[model samples]
Target: MTTDHPRTPGPRPTGATIVWAERVTKTFTTPDGRELPVLDDIGFHLAEGEIVALLGKSGSGKSTLLRCIAGLIAPSSGTVAYRGEPLTGANPGVSMVFQSFALLPWLTVQQNVELGLHAQGVGEQERRERALKAIDLIGLDGFESAYPKELSGGMRQRVGFARALVVEPDALLMDEPFSALDVLTAENLRNELVGLWEGHEAPVKSILIVTHNIEEAVLLADRILVLAANPGRIQAELRVDLPRPRNRQDPHFESIVDTVYGILTGREDAAVAAVEPTTTGGAERPAPTPTSAPLPEVSVGGLAGLLEILVARGGEDGLAEIADELNFEIDDLLPLVDAAELLDLARTEGPRIRVTDAGREFAAADILTSKQLFAHHAASRAPLVRAIVQALAATDGHTLREGLFLDLLRRGFSAEDARRQLDIAIDWGRYAELFDYDSGDGELTLDPGAQDAL
Candidate 1:
């Protein structure tokens, strides 16, 4: 795939600004009454004749930023403007496509596509005509009368696209619109979208897509904004200079993907340069506490699998290559990478992760030896694991209810998240043979030799 049409990267807008967000910050009140910051002073603009991707990991608040741009929600303190007009409610200039098809089950494809037009008070005849055109445009012409349940995942998503496009807004907002489909299906849709945009067939003037897939961002976006987690903020921005219909195997394309991966993994200088030295408002970040330090939700087997792969790759490989080979999104690999790093079993050098000697030995050891090695590392390195061990060790009976830990975790995480954290901790602890959990009793009991591993 290749294209003669070249797009310059960066903030150099080729057309008028369609949507702009300035210093947008969003905060949410958790069920525990804790104020959780999602977006931190985020700012960006979408201009006509461009596709921009908001790229990041799961916690980067990419969707939150997109919602704020759509005027579905107000920023905690900032402004969202559509063509110089500050938004007080839904921005009338844009329509959105969501990951979940979001089609009403009872509505026919035509009815679904006509939803926005109907809401905008379009006349019945005009709405039907336009809906038919959009349905045909999106390749669902014959399926106009088909119910959602009768459509495949791809067809269902096409209905979603038709629904958004039928509105003919100034900008199209997509929140991971292809993530729910199969790889081939997603690729097909992406290529079709690019074709529509390049051929001047798309109704909208600009497109804003939120995604966690690095290659997808490189594939379709003219500009990519890489966001960092922990109060999501823009970490780096890259302008893709490659022509449209990019080939995944192209060196330039692969290089751009690698660069973005580096920025995401904290290896690229661009990320370091974009990162603020202090917290937003110039306030210093607090030191990490046991509860505050999030555990990547990965199992012991998952972490071990990643280490084994690294070892097979001669102890290191570029993150992008690993993800591509394994048919995984970089986001899928992130938690395992995080877990390995947390346990000191792996270390990242730029865009590549290298397994530590400790990791190699653990991988090579027998089952009991592996457990002992893991226990030693878990007790010494993993904060949550160490906290659990220490708490149990200090108790006379060396047993405690799970609720005790969940309570402490709630100070940092929501109730559901707290449980997930504890569950991961329990898995790690049980695998290392450092503790035993009885689910029926909801209790964790320290194993007799737990302290010896520490």
Candidate 2:
């Protein structure tokens, strides 16, 4: 049995705090005048000699919080302190490595690496020496004169690492630094970085990384902070006590990975139900309102494919095995997992997903029967789909402009997110034959039998 490493909050590392954030909340005004909270009451501290990973799904504002720590952007509330000093501008003690390999095409690797020191007005001789040292340290010794355009994606990202490390700041903040590279290349770089950190070669005092990949966090971080989405909050914090050069096949490693999966999927508590109970009491929660439960941005085909795979695997399988088989980071599978659970097609037991009887039937049925089953579940279980069906049912002539739903969604979601939700809903509705949407006219017309779904 795997030991339970549930979120144990507090400062576990012995080193003094190098970067501290307290109750940092960030909210942005949408184009439509709606207040969209990105981070909610987030608090964490990075101590000297530790690497911490901010892990979460998309929209969890992991990147936003990282930027707040780097002082690239100020939080709407709360405070960020570097070594007991409040930051009023760009953090002097932090250097950032971006996902996009933000290197100027016109500059060579050495020049790009020297940009930080140049901005700080370092003398040319010292800057050159430091830039060369950083370039060699990051395994880019011979490529100092190569432009970004002339290097492979991994090489450019190495340049990014060199540039960030060149400053030798107190904290190195990385935003999905390996996300853009190919798998093998990324693994090579990741292994090298682990080597550097474990060997005490990297100059940064503390490291903070923002990532959506659970395995990466497990493989790299001493502490992992899992953030929740839709007004991001620190849902959980876990410390990994495993030894260096962690082995993936080790039982303890697998156990910790499963524990994180359970946390991410909320399976440690209960299988996802259509309505979650409130903390006030055992009061039955209301059916999700129009914008309360955002639909997982997955297609009907993808959902059906996942169910079929689950059925083929004797009706269940570990989330980690499935992700590995498909060459997907665990995060890539979350939306489909969520969709399956939302529609009652599958349920999660810890980290394993078991197909329900309904899921088996849907996977085995013919197209028409599958559509019927999907329509039934989507209308009764999926909040957004149910709302769309209900709205069309009440409208005159069984039709309404899509803008009406978009306007309502905007109250809760950002403009881009509102559009994404509508698009996903439209796709699901059309696939289930519950409704037809004309993009040209921006109108949705309910099918004759769609009302029966309600």
Q: Which candidate is the best by TM-score?
A: 2
Which lDDT tens digits does candidate 1 get at residues 1-454? 1223353433324699999999999988777687777889999999998899999886689999999999999999989999999999999999999999999999999999999999999999999999988888888878889999999999999999989998998999999999999989999999988887877777789999999888899999999999987678988888898887899889988878777877876664647554445443667778555665678888888888898888888999988789889988776897888778777899887667899999999887888899999999988888898999999999999999999998887765657777998998899999999999999999999999999877
**Candidate 2 lowest-lDDT run of ten:** 1-10
Off by over 4 Å in 1: 1-13, 268-270, 273-292
lDDT of 1: 0.87
TM-score to native of every candidate shown: 0.91, 0.93
List the candidate 2 regions with Cα displacement exceeding 4 Å. Answer: 1-13, 268-281
Candidates' lDDT values, in order?
A: 0.87, 0.87
**Candidate 2 local lDDT, 229-347, one digit each (tens):** 88888777777888768898889888778777777776535212212443546677787765667899899999999999998999999888899899887779999999999999999
| Residue 136 local lDDT, model 1 | 83
